[model samples]
Target: MNRLPYATVARCVSSLSRTGLYQGVDLRVLEAFDLDALAHFSGMQPGALCAGACVASQSSPALALTSANLRWCPACMAEGLHAALFQFSPITRCPTHNAPLIQACPHCGKTIPYRLDPAAVATPLACPTCMSPLVADLTILAHAHHIVGP
Candidate 1:
């Protein structure tokens, strides 16, 4: 699945564009947003109800937005929006043999393998039994090296 929903990609690009951070060098970081990893980037808990109206109208309760601190942005509403719809660009994964998903369970520190769905990039991948969120140490695509502006 693609990571960094298109919306966030769009927003990141727009944010960079507006802030003048969008240079050729940043494309590498942008390319890192693939359907495989993007679904986990929003930092939002799935299926949680959003309480405001500023959120994108199409967001699902499971895909509600959260502050960088991992708390809900109360001032913002959680309407049904495609998480990817907010990004200005698309996240492309490397064509190399699928990299191993190396995430650890936040609760247990257990290793979790990653898979690139190329779809469902907005959904979280949890432990098969506990459904715990897995923290990953991802390898940024080489192309992404150029996309993240200094």
Candidate 2:
């Protein structure tokens, strides 16, 4: 994705709000494409994509406000995609990969930026601190899976 200017993003958000496209939902959680072209561009059912983006408050415990630094599982990152659920504070582990999500870079101890610029960085998994790949140790993943019990 191209790096969009803040003004452009703001304008898009305002336009969407005016249209009531995202009624009663926080627009911050969605990416620019999701808000603008997801329904038109993707072949997947629009309902599935839309529903997956927002979680229902009644079904789960109240979530903590997302920090500027987001957390992610390195294993999941290796798949070349980031999961939206990783931004939720209550989600500590990757259910599919059985690995704990990491917020800070292991090498430089700096927090990963929540919104990554694909143009500036080769991939989202690259650490802004050490420029190293964000990979979790196998033993650590195994331990997490054992404790979390699938």
Candidate 3:
């Protein structure tokens, strides 16, 4: 994968990297990319996708995010989604699905950190260790399009 300016550019809600010691996306850098490009790559609206996260807009908090580990919502994952707010240190719950954010995989009980390489992002919504799904079927994911909606 191309090395983005700051780091891995997690497209929508469900993908990250495979290798090279890089981690999560830096929104300031990502904001530079065309929203159409991002949506074309990830099948989501860039603004709606990141609505839960803090970013570089003068009105928003300045990059107050936690990217070292993967903390997510199972209910949202069940529908094949991950919210950017999960990366916010202050957010311990999923306001959309009303589920607590979790760091460990339910299948293998392993903590899956964000990765941004080809292989990992290729199977973005799966557990790297157990090869189990981090989200439910991708088909189900389509039905949950309202996930990032206002």
What TM-score against the true fold does each predicted structure earn? 0.19, 0.53, 0.58
What value does the lDDT take at residue 8 in candidate 2?
A: 39
Per-residue lDDT tens digits of candidate 3, residues 22-138? 443443323434556555655567676455444644244555445546778888777555666687778899998778898888888987765443446555567778888776665
Cα lDDT listed for each candidate: 0.29, 0.51, 0.57
Which rank order by TM-score, best down to worst? 3, 2, 1
**Candidate achieving higher lDDT, 1 or 2:** 2
Error of 2 at 86 (Å): 1.8
lDDT of 1 by residue, 39-112 (tens): 34544432221221123322333223321112111111021111222222221221232322223444666543
Best by TM-score: 3
Per-residue lDDT for 125 in model 2? 48
lDDT of 1 at 120: 19
- Give me the displacement of residue 78 in model 1, in angstroms: 18
lDDT of 2 by residue, 8-95 (tens): 3334442344434323224224433344444434344657665655243323333344444757777666544456677777778898
Candidates 1 and 2 compared by TM-score, better number: 2
Segments in model 2 whose C-alpha atoms lie over 4 Å from true places: 1-28, 31-36, 54-63, 116-124, 135-150
lDDT of 1 at 25: 16
Clashing residue pairs found in predicted model 3: 16-115, 16-116, 17-115, 17-116, 17-117, 18-117
Q: Name the 10 consecutive residues with the lowest summed lDDT in model 2.
A: 1-10
